[model samples]
Target: MMLPLILLYLIGYETRVTTACSRLEACNSEFRTGLEVAGIQEPESSAPYCAELRAYSQCIKKANKACRGDLSFHTSTAVIDSLMKRFKCAQQNWGPPYKRPSVKPKSNSICSHQSNSEYVHCGIFGDPHLKTFTKSYQTCGAKGAWPLIDNKFLAIQVTNMPVINSSSATATTKVTIIIRRVPGCAEEKTFEATSDAPLRPFFVDSSYSTGPEGSVQMKASINKTEKVEIYLRYIDTTLVVRRVGEYLGFSCRLPWDIAKIREENALELCQTGCPGTELLDIASSRGHRLSWETALNKCKQDMDLETGVRNNLTDQYLDWCVFDVMTTGKNEFVSTAHLAQEDVLYMDPSSLRNRTFPLDLNGIPKPSSAAISNVTLNLQVTAVVDRCGRNVVHAPAYEGAPQVGRVAIKVPPIWENRIPVL
Candidate 1:
């Protein structure tokens, strides 16, 4: 579903200013309680509410720094001022109301990752950039609902929405991850998050830490008002879900041993990237377009972690930062790039250093442009920009990299991290 730009802006304000918003709500509750004590249920003439109205305005003004990132909070004092004008506190009385819009987190979930040395990183964030298990990166629109990972261990799905009005590009807005039931490992628990909604820190059943103590059980919540991390320690996998502005961003780290390719799970977005129809023209587009120069300058200036991030990553992040700002037309969106890299450093340190393929790495042919245009190309990460600075990506057409097909074929026995499912 396409969200209006105005709504997106409002939602964005609520995100960064969550703590201030919380304090404001608490103040509102206190004021309402005061009114109740004075027997003024709903002040008819605004006389009883005038004092509290002024107080509310003060509260808004005081929280200006705390909610500086939230444009909504900036207008709140103005809203009260207009309300007082209409109420005519000088003639009678005026004040803030009892109820208003709120999105408060009751119990937030935190992510704790059990680090694995040999792991393949697959991350999707900021207008939905895709980095596959094999280290191939592609920025495509995986719109609608698609399984990020569908296998015996887990089933993860993400929903993508158009980034802005008049743009075909999309960013993830919601994520629903199901850690399938395994007797020794963890219970079948689900963790879901959306851009505008409060996060569900615990499982659907409300029980915490279902897995055996010190065993492969579901761990605790990891992060904050903008990010949530769930650690499937049993499988040695870490899932990173974040809210960047009005859109959701997601990434995962899977152990190389468990990063298996089976017929049933071949079509997962983590493996196959987005379908061809969801392909976006990041290079050339009139709507929501930015010149390479403009986009580059914005990233260099706004991406605070540019130097540190450069050591760990390729120009991929700058590209994402540039794309995100252009697609959303909001400079704040550049932070998503910083957040994604920070997520990687925390989630998969090896990925930041270099590629993590443990097998015959040299034998495996990496997919790239011009070769797989005719063949069904799956993943495309790095692109060779031409003279016009057009970002062009092509799949690696090689025998080593398998194709997506319905043929049910036998597979070679790979190492398995088995926890007996009793």
Candidate 2:
């Protein structure tokens, strides 16, 4: 985001002022020494130099106030206070009349190295000089002093082959390719079950489409000697593919799963039913019964940790099946839940007007002895689920020390029966 030219200038000016203030004593040592010598025997409150001191202090305060009020500048109150103190001391020591020193203006120029032979001076918005500079550049370029030309190239890269199957008699592969107009545009294309000769060489033509101006078309064709099936599936498809780079190269072969579910069928399954409820029904039909609440809770918990659950069951299944135990591969009762006892801490009058507290290393607040008398800290034992949720286990409650002044309380984690069963 570009800032207004006026704002940029103000920012630069404020920075220079701050830099000057940092070395104020060295910058005006003679004036500061005069103030010190004149106020040696006088108390600051009734000193003869008090008037001059007040004037300097007020000047700094006003400047700092203006800096703070300006949205374009980020002023520090601490720095301003320090500057006021120093200025006041200088003024107090220099009794009698006072004259504020004039501040010099800094240069405001924006330049860049455009080429080996010439440097470019740019003009910002709201500056009349910018218009003149722009016209000058145009006129100069028209005379070929700085000519602009299109020297960019179009590059194509094959990203992925989600589906690659090769049998003794037939070969099939699905490929996703990315076309990039160097320094300009990009597009993705996917081909499904398109290549029958997976190993055959192919030619990609970069200048195939000219109907649409500035659009680069990539045309891939297999060798004439090879028999191939090329079917374009564009960008939208059921299979999930991540766009990678402008250039990548890799090849691999593995046993193809003939029984693998089709993308359309997998999508349909997710769209037709509720995730946990459908899974529970499937488990019950297979001789394993489970409560709807238990299954639903487990599914919700897992979904919360992963991406949010989708409305359609087919999408939910496709998204969660690989990570969830109930729907992935072979479903089984992998774990059990148990009830456990643990102590929990509670704070009284949960809301407090003051939040700042003197906290110890453990983050427990230390209140005064008198305040502690009225503060309440209690430990209550509660039932929680064990890791596996199979048996009951008694454990001490976990509670941190009480915080003083702070009304906010930190709630400890409560154990849950996370083991999903059927």
Candidate 3:
């Protein structure tokens, strides 16, 4: 669970040291935000970022006087002491003339925007199907935490959990996105979302964005579960991370130039899509006894009702809805499918209907609603068999794209069972 944000310091004039220390906790958080402002996402290697460390040390040292009383005071000091020691801040000069190190921008920088950026789209949804920025598509049993997007300006990660207790099949349950500080635009931001505690519109710092970058202001909040959108003004990007069923889903619209195939992003899931894995066709999974007619009709109806944009944005989502319904025996996926389509439309208003994606359906499926009946769901766990003859291994994942892995990882692709679930 995330700590409740404490931005306001409510220290009273009472003489009780405990009260002062309690308030000092707020100062501690405020002091740490300096790191965020410095564009340091990972605090583990914050040693070289000596400026922030010194600020924090000074704050703690000042608190040493009034914040003395209980074990909390001692404990807090111990933690801060350990952090400073670990970073070896004592050896470094926090004095004048001590220049701070530079943080190299990530390989995929966001300073450039091309004309085709409006049509560049990528997403991750049910069954962990991924659509890369290049319009490539693949369904992966990537059953652990994986980076959907990692660039100099932004990073998105998803954690997949088993759908059923004993099944190897998994879905995303958590999503975390990091927005690094832009030189003159937005400050660094962090956001977290889980199935139970979906994301809100604001960042962990309780701020939407650092005063809007020019005429276009950055957007930080959107509805949860249904569809969550965050507009990054600095990068000119829109990120959609949502919750569906027992998991989470992510989507993004980037400028084509920013999505160029680079050495570092060759293996990014959102950049290169998932590797070829013969996924168990959920629609044909045995024992599931699922009825796709209802979902097909539902998603199709929603798409048909939309008059604003005459695009086939719902094509992939329609397929995803049917697949999720067949896999989980639930029809809510129909709404999620509709939501994804609408989100894509809102995220990018370009003529996407004319744009071609690798996994685009020729047209929306036409399902007859004449015989709408209650879908029968039989959630029987089935064996997972790799449809392909290839041996399964814990394939390493990349940060920028799923092709070239730069981040160290221990996640293993454990879904050896290509078994279908009801």
RMSD of each: 18.0, 28.8, 22.6
Candidate 1 displacement at residue 167 in angstroms: 1.7
lDDT of 2 by residue, 1-422 (tens): 11111121111111212122422322223234435556433224334445444443444454554344432223333333343353465444445545545343223211111111111111101000010101110000011011011111211122122111210111012233232232222233222222333432222432333212323222332221111122111110111111111111111111112111134423211111112221211211111132333333443332222212111111112112212222222121111000000000000111111111111112123333343223212111112233654423222212221222222222232212321221
Cα lDDT tens digits, model 3, 38-144, are: 66644443444555656655565667777776444554455555556656767776564222333332344444232323246777776666656644445566777
Q: lDDT of all the models against the reference?
A: 0.55, 0.22, 0.49
Q: In each prediction, how many residue pairs overlap at the backbone (N, C-alpha, C within less than 3 A)?
A: 14, 16, 22
Measured by lDDT, the strongest candidate is: 1
Question: Per-candidate TM vs. native?
Answer: 0.55, 0.16, 0.50
What is the lDDT for 7 in model 1? Answer: 22
Tell me which of candidates 1 and 3 scores higher on lDDT.
1
Better of 2 and 3 by lDDT: 3
Best of the two (1, 2) by TM-score: 1
Error of 2 at 345 (Å): 38
lDDT minimum window of 10 residues, candidate 1 = 1-10
Native-vs-model 2 lDDT?
0.22
